[model samples]
Target: MQQGPEGGSKHMYMEVSRQIGRMAAKGARVLEFRCVVSELYIALRTILIASVTSLRCRLQKRMLTKLLNALDAAAELSTTDRLDEVIHNMVEVGKSIGSNSSVEELLAQQNLLVRMLKKMNRLLEEEEACKASCALCSIEFLERIARYVPSSTVPIWKHMKASIINFLAWSDSRVSEHACWLVTTIIDGDWVKQWSENSLEKKKFWKNFFALLQADSLQAQRLLEEMFTFPGSVTLLFSVTDDFNVESTVAKHLCCAIRHKQLNNSNLFPLVSYFSEMVCVLKDNSENESFLCTLRRLVKAFCLATSDDQSPYFSVRNNFALTIGAVDLLRQIDELAKSGIEIYKRKRDFDNGINGGNVNPASGLKQCLVRLIANLTCEHHGNCDLARKLGAVPILLESTKLDCCNLFMTQWAIFALRSMMKEDSGCRDIISSMKPTSDVRLD
Candidate 1:
């Protein structure tokens, strides 16, 4: 006898629910709680994967509600072993629901999120380190939901930010790790876009956020290290749009922090490391204009961080040279210049009504490359000699002539040329023999 679809689903639901119920009961036994929680997690995973449509149906909804109720009931029981299991299961359930449910569904069950947060707060208050860490795990999973349902979750997250920030400095590495993930999710998610629509609101949020990081050096270092795991975090943090004004604020504060000797090499090294990766990536993918733009902003931030006289790493010249070798940077700059020249030719051909190619001119990227070269060579003798040796003199000269319409590029190209020529008479002779016309102003 073949079972109908509804009957099959009902059978599956009943079996899963019974298993979940059995596990929930077992959880009350201290010696068996860990195994029970693991079994309960498996049961929930089966329900989640069986069929999302079926899981949203009445029977499955009832089963889920039953499971949540069981977890909550177990949470109230204070046995040392059982409490941790209960908390871990609660986190697993929250993660499953968040990953599967719609925003409306998540909003409807806001009480679940609140309960988890309150549990976290209470455990933290009691100084129950293990239990509090489990609660933070639950909060991290809830934050996954918040990333999608920001409109519904932002208000709650704002209320929870203090607790989240406090946990960022927790002595337990796991608790601190979860807290970092939660805070980064909130900041980099859509909610900040909504909250910072007003200029004043944007300024206030960034000011408070950076001030919080500044208040705790170890936490700040941990957060920075966490952010470095993702490639675009630096760019996102420094990006400016009409709705956000934090780029300048972050740059200023970073410079101040460095100058005041408030931050150490450990705090600043991640930025340098990430910057090195970006430079190499940009060299290979010069056609990616968006990535190039982000690279430029990040490079600008690096320049600012290192430009300070009082910076702990006061040997900015040697530090940058060692981190991003002068030879490698010059070679990359040469590749960028070649690409820029091709773009310039294509653009010039298009202007003359010639269908030379379909590529858009990368004048902006060329300018950024030259500007970065100038920043690197400004007072760095090694970079200056490397630029002269890597045949950068010709590239800088070519860049100055390629886009007369783009005074920005022209200005940077000229600055880079001046920097390269400052101590190298051969580079000076090369520029002099080129005899750039009066129209090609070096100033």
Candidate 2:
């Protein structure tokens, strides 16, 4: 009985030792046994595939073999959909290989994670043929990975970023939209503490991200629209310029984002500066009326943001001071008003006799001006001497001399002066100065 037990135990130990020897001979490191097995499986696959191809040569063979190994390891974990497990394995392998130094181990770990994530992305893209469902699934997985980023996961951030960015590049419009939605979630999430720790890195990421957006305006627009709904979305909106060939949807989305309080402050400089430039463009004589309408909507949003009681302009010394500070902005408004007046004049000159057949463009422009003035005044009048500081009173006077001037110009003038009179005494004086006087020149 004793002999039988010893013989059976010896045979089992011999079999186990032989299996270990075979694994070692195959260059499988015990610490990275899974990776080695995956690599070996992939190598066999590549060699089998190449044997059927017309291509030849040891160099090509070696390169493909290496690629296959990396690809196989990446595919194995990705196919299993066990991202955490793969991450743990990669960490263990890195630690074992670079055990002599912490820095080396960290670098090794980071490199492996990035490579694995990238390869896995490639595998999924290839296998799913970039279909919508596959892209959605992959994005969900990527988000899961993103959650690990601030911990031991920080090493994987680079890889995670690249994978998502690449997905944006590789997918079709619908798929790209999905990918962008995923990224915006991560960007707007609490992960800021993880990445924002390094100022230089933050700057670098911003620069690169900006460049990427610049390269594809449509994608940028889509991405930006998604970002707008995010908690810090307004910051991204202010960073974009009108010059980006941005889509109308993106512009509208940005408008919505800054409608909130926290967002307005975070994006004040860029938002105001960009909006100023946009106003100038919109007021130009050359712009079509349709564009004007669109611009009006944008202006409405700006007015909304700036008109709040707690607005940045709230502490101004006088009403017109805010207008004066936005002089260039007001200039654009003036140009738009002038354009409307000109249009009215042309219509009046071309039409036959009718009392209001020659109804003034100036009248329409006056409505816009009134709306603008009222909104601004409402926001700043408590602390600002608006009528005197911005010289709006004089402007109102000049706008009222309708009898001597062409009917359209005169109408706008009257409308403007009338609006000023409604505002304050300063406006009343400006209006009275333009009364029909014999000395006044009538061309």
Candidate 3:
């Protein structure tokens, strides 16, 4: 084993050469052997590269070190939503890494790491073990790997987006919110520049992007509210109502109505304005098909929540009014019947909000009367004032719809209509003189 003059293992080269010859002599060209050979070559290559003193190696080392630092910071940062910065840094470092690794290789590594970390985090979460540690590890891992490819990698972006989105759907609302926040920050990055140059187009893209998040948060609104806190996050919370993906339920209905009421009472109405503009954008015909659907759902939820609202804040009340400017939104269940949408459902869930028992017979019956008036007049008039001023119509209509049946809801809708309609002479006259056109046929 004569050593080479390069202060290297000269005998090692001889041994390697002899082994290759022996393998060749034995016709060891099987697929398994080839794979082993390939791996060996890669290991040798890495070792050689590490041993060399080159600018590229120096740069690679620096990027790797920076990425590791970012991971560490992500795990330890006490500040809020700081994962954005860590992920951003990781992206820069990942780009440098990608200069060496193929796009496919980088994507593969990123995906593997994300999968592993998610599994680990879930286990930790389930065991009620070191929640903070699990969160830190997961965030750091994602932040580091998320940077391997830019958003311009559409295929990779789709995968990464789904990975993050799945996290948003997690049972732990805090995890989901953090995941959503990460997604928003990443999409806001320069990678979207490839999608469009015009700033308006860019903004529109974000509107749709955020729309996805809006829908997701609504599914777990209460938990989401507790876990994540961003500057305009409150607006995002209400915006979820616009998401059609969320199935309307008694629970969600209550949540939306109650949350808005609470927000208004707490003097957080300025944040409501943040949603007003997006709601308008969502109303745009040119927006994506999904966006339009989401917008419709959001408006429906907003309508349901505000219908029974009694917020005294001028600004909060103004937002409620602004949301109505969209013609389509203004038409649902009629503006006049603000309290009408939930009459039927309300009868069922009244106990949840009221005295832990169903609404008392008197109030319950009045609610039913109110609903009838709101439904018919509001649908026809497109005016909340009609319902407000001539509330008498609601009682009469409920009596008729209920067919003298003892059903409380029917009576409530009618009474509500009469009470709201009586306030305005114009409404009273309209109600009195109104004839049921063919369009008004009883359903």
Give each model a TM-score.
0.39, 0.50, 0.33
Give me the runs in candidate 1 sitting further than 4 Å from their true place: 1-263, 267-274, 281-284, 306-314, 320-364, 402-405, 432-443
Model 2 clash number: 10
Residue range 1-443, candidate 1, lDDT tens digits? 89755556556666756765786776556556666456656656655655664555443345445545545554466466655665556555555564566665656556655655555454454434345645565566557655756644555564466456456546565666566566665553344344334565455444444544544544444554444334344444544232222343344345554545554454455556645665666556665645544554555545555556565554555654433443355466565445665543412322222464323434344455566677767767777776777677776776676544466666777887787788677778877887645675332
Candidate 1: worst-modelled 10 consecutive residues by lDDT? 344-353
Candidate 2 per-residue lDDT over residues 324-419, each given as its tens digit: 434344454555446675543322322333675423322233333434455555424331245445665554455444443336545544544454
lDDT of the structure predicted as candidate 3:
0.43
Pairs that collide, model 2: 317-383, 318-384, 318-385, 319-384, 319-385, 319-386, 320-386, 399-413, 400-413, 402-410
Lowest-sum lDDT 10-residue window in model 2: 52-61
Residue 438 lDDT (model 1): 63
**Model 2 C-alpha lDDT versus the unseen true structure:** 0.48
Q: List, residue by residue over 1-443, the lDDT tens digit for candidate 3.
A: 65333334334445555676778888887885676566556556655654452445455556555545555554554243444544455456545554565455455445444433443333333323324434544544455456556655565454455445445445566665566556544543243323334454434433443444446564344433332232333444344444434322322333454445533343234333533454455324322434433433333433344345343322233443332333222232233234453432233322234455433212232332234234333434434453334344433453445332245555545544554454445656767887765453332
User: lDDT ranking from best to worst?
Assistant: 1, 2, 3
Each prediction's Cα lDDT score? 0.55, 0.48, 0.43
**Residue 325 lDDT in model 1?**
42
Q: Sorted by TM-score, highest first, which candidate order results?
A: 2, 1, 3
